[model samples]
Target chain A: MAFLTADDIALLNEPQLAHVATIEADGTPHVTPVWVDTDGEHVIFNTAKGRVKHRNLERNPVVAISVSDRANDYRTLWIKGTVEMTTEGADEHIDRMAKKYLDKDTYPFRKPGEERVIVKVTPTQRLSQG
Target chain B: MAFLTADDIALLNEPQLAHVATIEADGTPHVTPVWVDTDGEHVIFNTAKGRVKHRNLERNPVVAISVSDRANDYRTLWIKGTVEMTTEGADEHIDRMAKKYLDKDTYPFRKPGEERVIVKVTPTQRLSQG
Candidate 1:
């Protein structure tokens, strides 16, 4: 698998929203807007286990995410990757993302019966534009 | 396939950037930012035949697109659909979309030795949020 460059990490660090697409078992697609993060390599997002995106990822790890610069829509990053999902520390991960995205100390949208999972995607290819 | 509502058309009519994801023959995803349009039912975008996105759509039409309101990032629309690609009138369609997104009289990005295609996506399901 390929890896993201420093420039790609810079784009991911921005406050722009990212859209992720996961293919279904039947080859259809399920896409959603997500708060995206990265550790300068792996792109990450957290979602509940019951969410459709989580279910799709469980069946097929292949995923793609695209995000444009909030200030300049022409500057964008597109990542093609496979995911590794883990439940450990998912709550903490969401809290960190909430702080980055919503200025909240904790994720305020948690449901009573939901279980969060953190998906870490290792890039196989990255398309970065200015 | 499902039909888009008037509200959905309104969203597509806005001058927001849209990202489309198409699954490659090997199931890896290819995502790109596009200028989007609609005829109150089908979402549309134009791409050159040599573009990676157009190649992916040719073999597997199942695609997902997400676009957020440029003015307010929270408002978004995610559409899952199958595409109908045609070359007829594609040049004109690109001019229209260029005018909307770039305020250009014609598509300023067309290249030599390229053939443009118009992709009309009929939504199978849509996820809209404000």
Candidate 2:
């Protein structure tokens, strides 16, 4: 199984923001900041099913995610991975991520009538800088 | 012409970091944080030729760039566009970006024997959140 190193996992464990990239149906790429998590072996983020990223990944699971330490400009990790799993606990996942990132107990921006989807990625390659 | 709003131009004009996403030759997406700049109308960054991203853009110019407000996660701009220009002057461009991001007049990470490539993007679609 793909795994982050002890040091790298520690880096990712912080509340730093992450950017997830996915390809559009027409081949254009789309990027957005995400609240990231890990299940020991896979990276994770939560979004709605019909969002651009979810739609893109449904058609093509390949992705590259970059996590940055905002306090230190030179520190970062890049994960080139595929969506090995799309699970259904986005509501709870977003809450967990919200606690980590926003210090809030619940995801602050969740809207009414919105559905949630969880994306889990398995890294095929990784890179780092500091 | 595609353009940013007054509020967004101010957000992006800050020294915050950006993540650029490009499509691979095989359809996989690649992403990395970059020191970003603007020509008031175009987005710019300096990279080296033959790098995975440069090669990818050469093969497929479409790209997605996301700039975040490090101090505030909710403020950002997403620019989806093609590489409108690949120009020279990367040395100077990198130095300029270094000033903005690192507070140094010259880029400190320059390596010997490496060529610099300047890539400029014209946003065809833009999105923002605050």
Candidate 3:
């Protein structure tokens, strides 16, 4: 079965931030609010290297992400997946993240070493309800 | 160890909204965004009676909630818990919800049957990183 319905994808495409959960080796869960960008195929986000989420993903990539809009009643989206980290290209990573959160005019350019570690989630399951 | 740090609790206490995940009977996860309130004990939220989140809770109450601050550099709160639903006092349910999201001065009084069913989460784990 499809993890997300048409309505669920609609909810995710709305411009909003989402909370992401990453699980630790001992089974503890770590969650953080992140700005996300979605293509028809995957969801993307970033985090610092020293953070627990980063560590959790290194140990195990299983995760859950939830998103919503406030004024629209109780609309929400939940995505579960494996996180794939990329250091593919510093400039490109920064560019994608900047576009998601900053307008073109204010988007910051990044130096090669200053780029964020990017994560792409190919959602294994998505559930949404309002 | 505490699932959330002191800084995590402060983030949770902020007026921002959160995305919550409730698990289904077959183990799929349902997530929604919600306005949350903290009494320093449990996190509270509500859902419509017929929604997937409500049904998920009835079958399996395990849930995860994530909250954050936007302007702050990556501040976040991830809470995992068991959900308890209440139909206990309709008037009080409406009152508490209104106070959390709406102003007390303009809060609407509910007829007993018009109140929302409330859910209380006793967080078993909290993890915060930013």
Q: Pick the candidate with the highest DockQ.
A: 2
TM-score of each: 0.92, 0.93, 0.64
Determine the TM-score of chain B of model 3: 0.75
Q: State each model's C-alpha RMSD to the native.
A: 2.5, 2.2, 5.5
DockQ of 1: 0.50
Query: Distance from true position, residue B13, model 2, in Å?
Result: 2.1
**Which residue runs of candidate 2 sit more than 4 Å off their true CA positions?**
A85-87, A127-130, B127-130
Worst 10 residues of 1 chain A by lDDT: A121-130
How many Å off is the CA of A51 in candidate 2?
0.7
Worst 10 residues of 1 chain B by lDDT: B121-130
Report, for every candidate in turn, its global Cα lDDT versus the true structure. Answer: 0.82, 0.81, 0.65
* Model 3 agreement with the true structure over A10-128: per-residue lDDT tens digits: 66666577777665555534456776766556777766566677787887776677776645545666677878888675346556666656755333644344446777888896554
Residue pairs of candidate 3 with colliding backbone atoms: B3-B126, B4-B126
Interface RMSD in angstroms for candidate 2: 3.0
Query: What is the i-RMS of every prediction?
Result: 3.2, 3.0, 3.8
TM-score of the second chain, each candidate in turn, equals 0.92, 0.90, 0.75
- lDDT at position B124, candidate 2: 85
RMSD of 3: 5.5
- Give the C-alpha miss distance for residue A97 in model 3, angstroms: 1.7
